[model samples]
Target: MEMKERQQLQYEHDLRNHFDILSLSRLDRLKHYGLHFAKYAGRLARGDAEAKSRNETLVDAFLVALSAANALNQKLQNAEVDTEDAPSDLAFTDHAGRFADACEKIDHLEEFRSIALDANAAITDWIVRNATVRGVDLDALVDERRKQLAQRAVYAPGS
Candidate 1:
């Protein structure tokens, strides 16, 4: 296969492996949420109207994931939940935090933010490149999606 094709395949393989690992670890909620993010990102890269309408930029997406990891870490540290459920959250939080913390210091508060910013940059580059290859007019798509979203907001319940 061509080098680009090979890279794409590898990316897909890595994503599947990561998903499998998360699922096997019984973190299905997190796995499903992550998968949805991936799927939405893919759709946006492919110029899907609804996905674009969601208005989730790469930065927004990265922040959401980072926030979840941070929340998990905080919850684990605080130990506000029952003991039986604490172990699993603690384990998952530690693993998630380690991705950002080179030293794995419990007090490394900004480590995850740095990781998330780097990840956002990489993901945004990848998505823009892929969307260009797909002949997606991102600016036009965003404009249209914004109009649709605005209309929806106008008629939305309690809005």
Candidate 2:
């Protein structure tokens, strides 16, 4: 392939990886909400207190945003553009500002999980795609580490 074509492929690969990592981060956040926040919201909604409904609504909105952010990050990471630097308008100050604001308002609320989940997913996805597009196997360096601990369990001294 021509140099330009190769470069284009590289860009695409990198973008996709970035998005995958981002998605991973998002998934983590959703998992957190699924485990904790969602229940809290449900409780508030069912409680007799007047503020409960509003609180639940707010929490629900934040959760939705968290999900959206995760999905978007995953898409970007999968596109291999993890480090492509989001445009200014899409930066945390912009796209995630609402999330940040919601987080600040939440005191007893659990820690926001969106960023962590999205980032991990984006990075992991990027690595996988990058290896494939570069015609290299990352199994030894990447997969080995991820699977080693699990594999070790299967071969434990007692087993």
Candidate 3:
């Protein structure tokens, strides 16, 4: 076999042996969590905090989801999954564009924070509602996460 073929075979072998299928499964679960975090950040951004904090959290959540999806895409690429055969490959491209758009919004937060907050909340609320037909109770989730963080701080070794 050629060197490239040999390397491909080795990569496949290593992936099969070292990969945990559960990680791939978890990636799917993370999609919803990421969207939730984005929506939550949008809601918070409408408040008095600095623009950087608000934009950062929204961008961070989006990047995390994009990163997870990219990892899975890398595995599929290694397996030689034909792009034409996988509609998800096209979806991934669409997601990459969304990620880029989020980054661009972050770049302009200082000048447009208030406007961005309202727009972000509107767009994210629609997305959240579409994702979960009943819609998310943002206040409840925010309260729960805050409590969890406070509990962690109290039990932290340094404190």
Top candidate on TM-score is 1
Look at candidate 2 and tell me the lDDT of residue 127.
33
Number of backbone collisions per candidate: 0, 35, 0
- Give the 10-residue window scoring lowest on summed lDDT in candidate 1: 74-83
Name the runs in model 1 displaced over 4 angstroms. 1-110, 155-159
Full ranking by lDDT: 2, 1, 3
* lDDT of candidates 1 onward, in order: 0.37, 0.38, 0.37
Query: How do the predictions measure up, each by TM-score?
Result: 0.35, 0.25, 0.26
- Model 2 ranges off by over 4 Å: 1-111, 139-159
lDDT, residue 82, model 1: 24
Following a full C-alpha superposition, what root-mean-square deviation does model 3 have from the true structure? 18.9
Per-residue lDDT of candidate 2, residues 1-159 (tens digit): 222332343334334433343345543444443334434434444547545543233323332333443343433333443443322212222323333433443443655445434543333343334344544434333333323323445444443
In model 3, the Cα lDDT at residue 137 comes to: 40
lDDT string for model 3 (58-136, tens) is 3333333323333333221112222333122233334333534443554455333333333333333333332234333
Q: For residue 39, what is the lDDT in candidate 1?
A: 54
